[model samples]
Target chain A: MDHIEHLEHTESPANMKKQIWNTFYVLLVLTVVDIALYFALLSSHSIYKNILFVFLGLVKAFYIVSVFMHMKFERKFLASIIILPMLFICFLIWLALTEAGYTFDSRLF
Target chain B: MSNTATLSTDNKQTWGGGKSPLSISYGKLMMWVFLLSDAFTFSSLLVAYGFVRFTFTTSLPNAIVKPFSHLSHTFTEEMQKAGLFVTERWPSPELVFNHFPFLHGIHLPLMFVSLMTFILIFSSVTMVLAVEAGHRMAKKEVEKYMLWTIIGGAAFLGCQAWEWTNLITEGASLQNNPFGPTAFAALFFIVTGFHGTHVLSGVILNIVIYINVINGTYEKRGHYEMVEKVGLYWHFVDLVWVFVFTFFYLI
Candidate 1:
């Protein structure tokens, strides 16, 4: 018998229809939320606007990474490896951004 | 790489028939690495954009720019109709992509970009369908879904071409833009363009899979393992776009 006769075992998505519909559903909802927030932020200012924006942005990002990217189904160790770097980089980048803001306040351009 | 080794044993050969016995395909593995690197590249671009945005002459693109303030209200009103989001002064996605021919100020490249994002998102959905079809031994349906995926991939490329054209057009040149921060044009063009290139190449690779699928290449070869791997790549592209949409458009 030829080696080709043996079966090839590839991974399959856990729940096809459910995953697809749910991902679209969440994304649709977020887009709506974003639109609404756009109005609220525009009319009258809120002290907590920045916090709200960041919070909502994270929610959207989370769904993309977890559901769309299938990170939720990914192995724990592998997922950790991916997220660890992302977290660290975001932190360092924040510091750099803050430094950039302060640098502009100083002397001549 | 041992001669006796086969995909059935280690699950490497399904990736592609290259060296020793392996289960998965090489192309799929490489795509993951490339995507990871691309992720870092975007991070750096965003970080640099942050620096530029902070140092710019104006208060900020989103905070100032009063006309954009109007769209914020429009978006809020629309969201209220849908019952999906909270409303506020929405920044005009139009000002960002105002160069298109027919849809100039009427919700352009943003609408088209949303179209592109949805195409990729839907392709990911179809890709899963194809994989399932393959597993069920439904060759006709497998080919049907695969073909639809290829068309989806192509449509996304066409959208990108329009986007790039609008970006590089006369008024919208890297030089001028009524809206956006100083570094806004440069960062937006670079980030979005790079992502577009990735989508373009993915279309070609998908074309190859489509060909293989029609020829029943995997059937005789056994197992549609490559589908899983490529599906990952497609989904990742969609994933990245979701962030791009949020950061560049709505927010």
Candidate 2:
């Protein structure tokens, strides 16, 4: 019973509720911004507009992971174990988009 | 001095047997790792979307149709006639996903998806709140929040079903898309379909957890870590939606 009780991990701050709502508002605002930017930049069709949208998405992602996911309070070692591996996704995006541009060019001209 | 040496021993003991060095429960840690692997799966799908999307030319500018403008019954046909929907270029998501339930012939571009995003995000918030309540051993609070989370999840699924129906009615499928490219419809269905399946499962899991909460399972066990674990999965579903919204509708 002692060992089983030890397996129960509970570590949350008192103001966690406040933090949750704040993060909710932040996500809400960021999503509204996402839509606003989409329409504002509709006619441009520039790569920078896409990057801007992606950047906003990443901001929203950070808040969700850090607050709602309770990652901010987790141990550094645990956080790294879960987050560090995702760096490969960045590399994959870069590689894929780079190749895609070449494919587009080859097919076009 | 010897105090430093004792501290080193204490640190070593943390890594030694009889303790969890990471300070997380075995099940919760497993949940995190599972979410990480799941994140990778979603990332691969979204990245593939980006790759395929980047290969296609951008959609032509639509200066003719403004938001809130009255749409005709032959909207897709008119767009195709106007060269807005073609095989050689990608179609703007705004034009493709403009229909909302019961508001036909209205050019409300990304509004429905934005509502979907809000639904998923609000559900995620409720889920975390349930986890927070579980920490306090507030059984009633946990039950209420879990129910809300389930409702949010269900509402999101309904919204998706409606959107999917509208698209299918507009003649979108795996092999055929009246929109710009067939691949667009295919990828849209696959990515959002995959994410929708996750939401469905999350709702099911939330229902299970809600039942357990009502039955006082966690209260009897003296911990709500199960809620926390499921909370992580629910949040992950929301996280994937953020990207899906970015790649599919916003981009």
Candidate 3:
């Protein structure tokens, strides 16, 4: 009976559906923006173009993990446990790019 | 040594027990750890793709032929006449992935892929809905959302199959391609094939869970943790696709 009461007291299904639709709309808008930027920056050699793409991609990724995966509602310690390894991934990216740069230089020179 | 021994004794009292340090269940914690390790595997693959692509592009020769030249013989001739084929270092992804469903022969660059991305993301939303329904112990709602989620997974897999078929039929293989560099075809196949395999497995897993939902397995267990666990995997797959789209196609 207490569990039944708790269910009734919690957020309604309509409210949950609203939140889901909001997230879907946000993701759809981001994707449209991403595709537009892809074409807009197609011929440009600017470094900022790549930076913007990565930044937007990360934002989308964060939303999916946090909301869709419910990581945002998880305990802080659990969130950290899942997210901390990303630092090591960043280190891997840095190392790989640096090595690639060196390889390119050597091949060219 | 004596000081370290004393610290070890103190640590045992506070942290050495078998309790879950993060206050999550053992199953969920294990899943997170598995996903973390899986993330590393994907990161390494994408990093390798970056390294190969950078090296290939920087070292490309002048006057590279357009990709899929054989299929575009007339266009290639016109481009050759216009001296357009004399430009470009590596094959651009926009040109490579331009084919759309049933719009064959039209240059619809990124349209099909964007549609695929939308489907995957929408399916992810359904997955979260399923999890939400599970939390409320709404079995009917859970079943409905889970069915939608399963259909989404299957559809994504079907799209991937179509994409792969087009790639192969258009002359891209692990070893060779009409594309600029051999490594281009190789990395494309490896990274996307790995992801396709994941989606296939995810679809199968979703079907299993959907069946179990219909069987009242979770109701018998008195909780819907299974839905939440599978949701983590599904969301992880979508997360990886976001990175794959950005790194492989957009940039």
Q: Taking the true A–B contacts (Cα pairs closer than 8 Å), what share appears in each candidate?
A: 0.32, 0.80, 0.62
Model 2 achieves a DockQ score of 0.65
Q: Candidate 1 lDDT, tens digit per residue, B216-240?
A: 8888777665665677677666666
What TM-score fits each model? 0.71, 0.95, 0.85
Give candidate 3 regions above 4 Å deviation: A1-16, B1-20, B58-88
What docking grade does candidate 2 earn?
A: medium
lDDT of 2 at A90: 91
Candidate 1 chain A worst ten-residue window by lDDT: A1-10
Candidate 2's displacement at residue B250, Å, is 1.1
For model 1, the stretches where C-alpha displacement exceeds 4 angstroms are A1-14, A43-57, A107-109, B1-33, B57-94, B98-110, B175-182
Quality of model 3 by C-alpha lDDT: 0.77
In TM-score terms, candidate 2 sits at: 0.95
- Residue B151 Cα positional deviation in candidate 2, in Å, after optimal superposition: 0.5
Backbone clash pairs in model 1 (N, Cα, C under 3 Å; residues 3+ apart or in different chains), count: 28
Q: Per-residue alpha-carbon lDDT of model 2 for A1-109, expressed as tens digits?
A: 3553363243678888899999999999999888888888898988899889889989998999999988887776788999999999999999999999999998799
Docking class of 1: acceptable
Question: Clashes per prediction?
Answer: 28, 0, 0
The lDDT leader among the candidates is 2
Alpha carbon deviation, residue B16, candidate 2 (Å): 0.9
TM-score for candidate 3, please give it: 0.85
